[model samples]
Target: MSEDWTRLSAAIRTARKARGWTQHQLAEKAGIGFSTVQRLEGGAPFTRRPPSLDRIERALGWQLGSADAVLAGGDPEPTGSVDAAAPREAGDIGAPPAKRLPRRIEHELASGEVLDTEVLQLGNSRVRMIIVATFEPGDGDDQEAVAEDLEAWTRVQHQLRNMTPSEGNP
Candidate 1:
């Protein structure tokens, strides 16, 4: 088991170096902590639960079972899921396929109060809208409640986005 771990560690180090990625860069790309990457690459023993193999594979642009193969001292194989030949920045590895943007729309009512609406957009589609705040004189609505509701709604939208298929036909 130790030998397998050692081989896996070496393979990880080699793949990271081949891509000109530092430990910190790998951590960021893999969505893992810097110390996790350090510990793995440092061969700190397989005594504890390791980082997610899926995350490491995604970060290194390797096939799904590549980690297992490397651990068994075999060659890594391409999954052909992502274009390995294409140049990718560290920021692009674990980033969401769609970009998110929050847009604020405010209007001054006839009563001199401002009605503020915030819309969260994922890529070109608007995913969520919240009445962020009502800036009115003598208004005492709990702003914290509004924030909490918005947060919960945002989480739901994110989950929906993940569950939905990216390809329209598929």
Candidate 2:
């Protein structure tokens, strides 16, 4: 096996173990398939569009460029010793913190309402909204009730869409 591959695989294994996470947990946290985690931990050849090293780094909470260095045959310093109290470098003073993607927001329509909405932020500036409403079964099937429910759902969807900022705006 190539030295770089072996080093990278070992680093991944060590980092996962340090967090007391199983392969399945790591895969879930990384938003990747369990089998992919297995292959990576098993040191299988990284073929067929392997997951991005950046994704794995984010999932593992390692400092940026740590995985890249391992894959490039360089030893990376452990991330646990980062000196938060240290002064920032001159060039990095104004650098913004990295944004974590794929956030989720959930809220209810009213204090006691059975309707709830969840917003999932997909990467690359895309988002999906899901609305859920619950109702107790009626005495019998009621067409009018069904139609009312549909109308309420449609109105909620429209309101949510309008609340979202337009693409043209910042």
- Predictions in order: lDDT: 0.62, 0.59
RMSD of 1: 16.8
lDDT of 1 by residue, 55-108 (tens): 677667777668777776787776555323343466564453223221112223
Best by TM-score: 1
TM-score of each: 0.45, 0.42
Q: Which residues of candidate 2, in runs, are more than 4 Å off? A: 1-3, 47-49, 77-170
Pairs of residues clashing in candidate 2: none
Superposed by TM-score, candidate 1 places the C-alpha of residue 18 at a distance from the truth, in angstroms, of: 0.8
TM-score of 2: 0.42
- The residue-by-residue lDDT of candidate 2 on 1-170, one tens digit each, is 34466677898898888777887666656656667677777766564325345556666766656766777787665556322223334454322223443222122323234544546443345445445565555678589987887698778777765674558662
Consecutive 10-residue window with the lowest summed lDDT within model 2:
102-111
